[model samples]
Target: MDFKLTDEQVKLRKEFYDVCKDLEKRKPHGFAGLESIYDTDEGWEYHLYCAREYAKKGWISIGWPPEYGGKGTIGDKVFFAEARGYYDLPGIDIFGPEMLAPTLLGVGNEELNKRFLPGIASGEVQWCELWSEPNAGSDLASLTTSAVRKGNEYIINGQKIWSTGAHRAHWAFALVRTDPHAPKKQMGITFILFDMRTPGVTVKPLYYMDRAHVYNEVFLDDVHVPVENVVGQENEGWRVTQLLAGFERSSLGAIMMMLRQLEELVRYCNETKVGGKLLAHDPLIRNRLAQMACEIEALRCLGYRIADAQERNEMAGFEASGVHILASELQERLSWLGADILGPYGQVKRSRWSPFDGWYEKWYQQSFVLFIAMGTNEIQRNIISWYGLGLPRMK
Candidate 1:
């Protein structure tokens, strides 16, 4: 496959990189320079304000179509890579514009697209995915959340766990069962978006081991939504969900965060010494670093390959699944390497003697959560086995 980017794509990517450079240069000092500065509500408020200002400056549309107030720039992988390389941005909630945009643009009604796409692309609105019900995770089609149609509205009632960023998001794109008697488990599902501020919608904070409120439990209690919010045909949401999950898995931007963490690991290893020598000088640590670098390069190429397939309108079924699985695993491994480099400090969360500005201190604590987010590695492997390899069901 050719590794060349077109002239226009190259130009747009360079422009994106330039903008990120400016954002990085102008970013606030203190805790803002950290990987995830917006862990707190107050910190997020400031981050959102920055995001809004960045949006107004047209700094938020690398993956959206032009008709939806975006630059309609293609070659999203190139643009995202350039942005991450230029700016130290932690890549939070990037799926909203990249993964969710494609799903909405492809299947959403004209009205729905027109109403939400612009705001979404502009960073005026934030969206969270309400997937992973208690009983249904990897087997997402087995979801039991119910959305019954009545007049021009659908009343939804269900509980969604591990809804990332729902506490800060303005809306949610969720899957619900609109048909109880559908022939197949996947047949009754529908994809819909609803306001998080609606009555009967309860948001319960779920704290991680590090005492960070990142994930949430969202309860929908007979919440009413306009029928227009539904994407594609009723009871066909499973297909849309499949496509969306593919987008999420295939996205190249997720690895950028890992890339940043890798840089931090190198710096920490070099600065922290053991046995009167730098940790980076150790053979085992050096080998681990070399392995991480190689894996990251491979993952980067895989991401670009997915993007190339997307540009050619090819279905990247198992490749995307494998990429997602590999990326998350590499992230966890890198975090473990960080903890190892820190030694006893690996387990510490808050202290005056932490290294890497206490970044690894936090990552060492929250590394497990990375494996389970979006979808677990087990789910990803199942997708590859069943969908990619055409494996037989166990039962």
Candidate 2:
């Protein structure tokens, strides 16, 4: 329950915030929104620029063990996330550093960690997830992607859709059916890593509604991966997948983004008048904003509790899923509120007509994606009900 930071953590957190604040000032001319991440080459390059900077300063290695070059705790990681999300900084990749490194620490061989951890920690490489497919998004265990093993390698052949950052990533960690004849759907699956530039690997764009190419459809045709790329046992990747999914869900970045958006909302309301009264003065807007504030605070508290549980090695609970569902749904709700407040102005960004530089406009369009990414909120709910509450399975 004690959420106070130690003096050292406080100093470290401020350093991270100062760096992000400075980056915000020095960002590219058109780098005001996440849209820049996918809509223009400048945006992409700007992201890489940020990535290298984070790598150089070791921000990317927060909370990792000292042996792995990490020099902070779980609290320090949360503090850094708030700064990154507040500034909406680019360059800190979620897939490679955030999701995979933790998974490796949990289940990978020393050699695997020694090989992959450095690239991610150094931010020299970027990674993507290859989990969902045309028909296996929510029902991920049913994924049909196959990685057939030979003596020394696995020949992977399948398709993965809705892969975020796949088009721009240097590598991917995929779940493939290594043994098709296993008795259960979740059994016999393998977690494998491979270079995106390998032969017969194709990445085609799957743009958002606003035509931004942040997600992609990755096709693998007889792609070959060395046995060393497998993270654990050849066919027991489900456990690692679950572990990684928990990390993805518990990531505090989304909550931090919502916190920043709330601040922007308050500022807009204070400055804008509607019907001869400031928007902040409207009862309905005030109520909605208040509700969002409550939800965000609760989410932040939950994040801290989860981090504490993780620190204690006592997080054998549904808190991760709970945080994911709350954060993603809250993001969607915030986006909708912003759109409703902005009215038509919310629909446009980078134009003089848009408020907040059309930042929420992009968020409004992509809001629903957050609920489904990492894993669907529906799935998270089911997990909470069945596992957390001990509810019986649905027929």
92-187 in candidate 2: lDDT tens per residue?
A: 777887789999998948898899999998878889889999999888899999988888989999999988888888989999999899998898
- For model 1, the superposed segments whose C-alpha errors exceed 4 Å read 5-11, 25-38, 57-59, 85-92, 248-251
TM, every model: 0.88, 0.94
Best by lDDT: 2
Q: What local lDDT score does residue 102 receive in model 1, on the 0 to 100 scale?
A: 76
Q: What TM-score would you give candidate 2 relative to the actual structure?
A: 0.94
Winning model by TM-score: 2
